[model samples]
Target: MTDFRLVIVSAGVSDPSSTRLLADRATQRVSSLAEKRGHTVTTTVIDLRELLPELPAAMSSQLLGPRFTRAVDALVRADGLVVASPVYKAGLSGLFTSFFQVIDNDLLIGKPVILGATAGTARHALVVDEEMRALFAYLRTLPVPTSLFASTEDWTDKALGARIERAGRELVLLMESGFARAVRDESWDSYQHSYGSAGGTELDIDLSSDMMRLATGGSLRDSDDDPFDPRRA
Candidate 1:
């Protein structure tokens, strides 16, 4: 049986947060479904509240504390992800967005992810699909077709559970297909990646390139070449 790693990032701030509750439910379903498919699933939970102390440093100086470092490590190794956030002022929690904003741009590329969000009122239900999906899209993550959003009333509603089940199954199917891993293994170079990005595992560099030479204070043209010649320029 193939083994898969799943990471759950919960931006819940309360002890019994609905946000985390939603995320946990999704995680459980995904695990169960994957197990039924004869796959082993390992999970890592990253509670964003625990990383609050590191957020400022991460945002200000790009310094990752121990917990933040661990979070990034978990994300890098994750085969699939369940990300849940709380809504505030008609938008996603600042803590939720901030944490992702500080990570490498290519860290989540091609990774299968499920978007979930919790808000007090049903009015904010669209936040997950409208805002959170956009953020994951920018990271180039492959979010499942089903998105989960829960309001206070949705907690007891059967519809929320249905969505969670659908999302979980979708995630499991995507993971089983190994789409993300295949994309990374086969077409990784086709994607745009910044230097030292992807949690610093992307170390490939072409020393002979003009950009590299210029960055290292090396001249593109040799001393023997004519300085003003268009052919040598």
Candidate 2:
């Protein structure tokens, strides 16, 4: 059986939050679907509320502590992710956004992500599509076509369950197909646009160009025997 790791990030603040409930429902469905497809799935859930105290340090210092690091590492190593947040001010939670802000930009590139959101009313449902999707897009993650949004009333609605199953199925199919892995393996170098990438340099510059030559203090052709001698004017 294929081994898969799934990470669920729930940005719920309450003791028994609707956001976490929605995330749990999605994770259960995805796990079931993967099992049906002959894959063994392991899941890790990160509740951002628990890490709230460390967020300010992470954001300001741009460094993650051991606890926060472990959470981000789980996300980096995950084959798929279910990210859920509670909507505030008609958008995603600030805590949710801050948690992601400390992670490396390239960490989630080409990874499959299932976006979810919860709010008090259906009027805030579009936050999943507009806000959450845009955030994952910026990270270069492949968010499934079916996004899940749960309002307070949706907790008892059968249609919410159906949508959860649909979104879960899409995530499972993508994981089974190995689409994210293949893309990361084949085109990773092309996506490297900053330091510490596998490519060693940004892709936009040509190392052999005149600008690069000048930047590197000219070519290695001018070799003077005297160490103290300057170049002849």
Candidate 3:
């Protein structure tokens, strides 16, 4: 049986947080589904609350503490991710956005993600698609078609469970298809990547490119080859 690693990033601040509960439920569903398909799943959970102490430093100065470093390491190895955050002011938690903002942009490229959110009122149910989806899109993650959103009332509803199962199945199928790995292996160069990104695993640098040469104070491209050059104009 093949093995996969799943990382759950929970932005829950309370001891018994519904946000984390939603993520855990999704995790359970994913694990069960992967097992049914003859695959083994290993899970690593990164509780954002635990990174609060380092959050300010990370946000302001891009300083990664031990906890932040560990989170990044976990994500770098994750085959899939379940990211859940509590809704605040009709949007995702600041902690959730802040954590993702500080990480390397290339880290989650082409990775499959399951977006989830928990809120007290159903009025905020749209936050998952309206807000969370946009964030993951910007990160260039492949989010499942079904997203999970649980209000206090939704927790007891059977629909929530069904959605969790659907999202889990989609994630497993994507993993089995090796979409993320294929994208990274074959088409990574088609996407924008920064040096030392993706937890230092993204070491591919085109040192012979004109941009690299220009950055190193080398001679510019020939005026005939530069569309924007004043001489060409």
Candidate 4:
């Protein structure tokens, strides 16, 4: 029963937002599990709609600097994260997407994030899985195996409740693993930044020359290896 904090990123309107509902349910499941383990749990809920015109896509990085900074801070300080959003026109809400895009990717590296979403039908569930995973991938976050999706019908569905419980457990397990490994690996991650700046692979000089040689009928050679023979290693 260690102390753990969970952050919910919900992009939903103030009304009966299915996004926040699903997120709340998921958090409850995790909090219950935490209680059972005698662990204290704290939560910070950030509703993108609550963020207002400040969260507009184009200005998300600037106007919402404090909020955006808090979001990044939450990712760093929290043991795990649950991101829930309502689908919008076959895509994730712009607020959610922009919020993520503006952050420092290093904050999410190796963090366990649970992907969840709500929509009118079940058909869009897989979209969250694939597209959402891609986003986490870019952030270098380790996503849990169980992704939560709630269709309009799922709001009151019993099975959906069970699924939320399962996702919560899965997320907890991932975070626990991270906690254990992070202690040992934290040094490496922290010091890795002190090394050389982001390095792209060196230009393949050999390949470049080979291609040129082929393109010009062996005009380019391995000059480094054999200057006279016109062949460079």
- Model 4, position 109, has a per-residue lDDT of 64
Writing each residue's lDDT as its tens digit, candidate 1 over 143-165 gives 99999999999988999889999
- Native RMSD of candidate 4 (Å): 8.1
Give the candidate order by descending lDDT: 1, 3, 2, 4
Give the worst 10-residue stretch by lDDT in candidate 4.
Answer: 194-203
- Put down candidate 4 lDDT per residue, 168-191, tens digits, no spaces: 888777766765247426643442
Task: Write down the worst ten-residue block by lDDT for model 3.
Answer: 224-233
Q: Quote the lDDT for 149 in model 2.
A: 93
Question: Against the true structure, what is each candidate's TM-score?
Answer: 0.92, 0.85, 0.93, 0.75
Looking at model 4, the pairs that clash are 221-232, 222-231, 222-232, 223-232
Clashing pairs in 3: none
Give the better candidate number (2 or 3) by lDDT.
3
Superior by lDDT: candidate 3 or candidate 4:
3
Off by over 4 Å in 2: 196-216, 219-233
lDDT of each: 0.93, 0.85, 0.92, 0.72
Off by over 4 Å in 4: 56-64, 179-184, 187-233
Residue 86 in candidate 3 has what lDDT? 96
Which residues of candidate 1, in runs, are more than 4 Å off?
Answer: 213-233
